[model samples]
Target: MEEVDVVIVGAGIVGLSVAEKLSHSFDNILLVEKEDSFGRHISSRNSEVIHSGIYYPKNTLKAKLCVKGNELLYNFLEKNNLPYKKCGKLIIAIQKNELPILDELYQNGISNGVKNLEIISSKKAKEIEPLFKSCGALFVPSTGIMDTHKVMKKLEFLSEQNGVLISYNTEISAIQKQDDEYILSFKSDDFQVKTKILINCAGLWSDKISEMVGINSEKNDYKLLFCKGEYYKTTKYKDIKHLVYPVPDPKGIFLGIHTRINLNGELSFGPNAYYVDKIDYQMDDSYHQEFYESVKNFLEIDFDDISQDDCGIRAKLQKEGEKFRDFVISNEKNKGFPNFINLIGIESPGLTCCLSIAEYVEKIIE
Candidate 1:
């Protein structure tokens, strides 16, 4: 029966970013998380790569927000003393036939205002990463990686300092709209609290959360398809300085098996896309054969000791055989509920775009 100004569900990066921004303006804010800690879902499971916003179509939310967010994130990390690296990335064209596609990608990056993107010859590409063998490549100097968990922790701390209450292990059951306010029912520990504005930032379960609010169900137009991607870690540390990528599939849904190094300088690969029926993270060893075949085309590696590390699911708005969908941040109109916002299908570059998404959401509510 407590009345609060805002109730944000899901403690992932997006929700936490929004909460951090909202707390600066609103005093009575509650951040609820079904899990015991933040970033346990999609936020923590990703490749932790800070995207350069080169792949998305121009003028779309993904393109604009990701480009904007990339700058903001770099600045934030530097200012806050967080761990990060602007290690750059290389989009490699392994075969002769893929050269044209590589050119198209370089032009797309330039058109999208991606700074310092250069088309390097195969010889120059080898200078950057000696082990990589490619016909041609595009070097994205702005692409980087970071510790996603550390960033989330900083956001959480900042929000708490600004008077935002973070309630963990809290699950929202139902939501209803009454006049200008939204009533949210959630259980925390042994108690429950109902509040006015409810922001659903549930990454994977966002669709189910929308249905709970009487929106985007079988009767509605919006739907979410869960896509699972798995990652594998290489045992031997190869000296690949930059993040190496193969020419993206024309469909643009999957970014072929690539190489990424973490903050500790450990190399990891994979995240091949596969559509799934349910949300699960169980690693299947049988997929190793498929992974080896997929990655062997671009880089040579000893897969002898390679093992499954982790997996992440992307909540996509598109169905099977569909191109990548843009981020959907809606409030009220789509579901007829004022002060209730639903963010569905926030996948790749999501971590990079977290700050920009938060700033946009704050403007919407303001």
Candidate 2:
């Protein structure tokens, strides 16, 4: 058996960030991932949009961390000379009935302390993005796009340079708490580890990881519902500039499918949401008509403009038709597992919230 001071599961951006931050404090740190490389799942998929903390409600972890992470992420990008674009974002209202939702988003952004949020006329919206159709829009200047792969790679570099050992293709099949240490069982039978502290950052499988440590996921409302989102791309991006969005789902199941611009100045649209029982990333044209109908309200394009691209699944704490659920990042001491931290339902603003999430977790250990 191997012993380490700390072990962090999941090598996604959040886990990598935690590793990099904690490396300065802990001499012995291990990061384990089931995938062959980091960020292979939720971290690498979907739009790499750096959010402006606009959509989340007031005072929640999503709101606070995202608002703070927006600043921290950009600072990290600039400080590291990473590739990114501060392209701004426009959330649009296509009809009079939707104006209230736009206003609601603006107010929420203000409540979350998001700066430079403005309710702009359709004219102003079109000026920023000529192909977009809107009656009114919420302009978020701080919203931007980034190369997530680069960001993850840089974090991986920093973590390694700080002497954090990352074990790839390693999966922890089971975990047991004995006295004050956690005994982790691996599927490969190659070796085992006992850590003084465990941080479960396994995004989609976080709930299952919690279960391994005697926490009843269902009893504690930590059950994760797999929500799958698929994307589409188009060459019609020639005129598209800034990021554009439709009013989010009122149930909060997702931020509505919107225009996702890449760093290359090309545009892709989609990530239409639906709950799924299995994890699958195989893309299909099943939602073609639905996507065409949705984004056509906000973007100018022919029905033939889009074809299915890639897809990703989110491990959300909110079940179908459920109310908004904040990110479940917490220490489980009172639940009887001291020094064990569980990060569940980390979706959306998670990319924007990575650094702040790391700081919050580090504080828990300190």
lDDT of 2 by residue, 69-129 (tens): 9999999999999999998888889897999988888888898899999999989888887
Which candidate achieves the best TM-score against the true structure? 2
**Residue by residue across 98-208, what tens digits does model 1's lDDT show?**
988888888878778899998999999999988878998999999999999999999999999999999898898777767767667765444445666788899988888
RMSD of each: 1.6, 1.1
User: TM-score of model 2 relative to the true fold?
Assistant: 0.98
Q: Model 1 shows how many backbone clashes?
A: 0
For all predicted structures, in order, the TM-scores are 0.96, 0.98
User: In candidate 2, which residue pairs clash?
Assistant: none
Q: Candidate 1 has what TM-score? A: 0.96
> Highest lDDT among the candidates is held by which one?
2
Alpha-carbon lDDT, every model: 0.85, 0.90
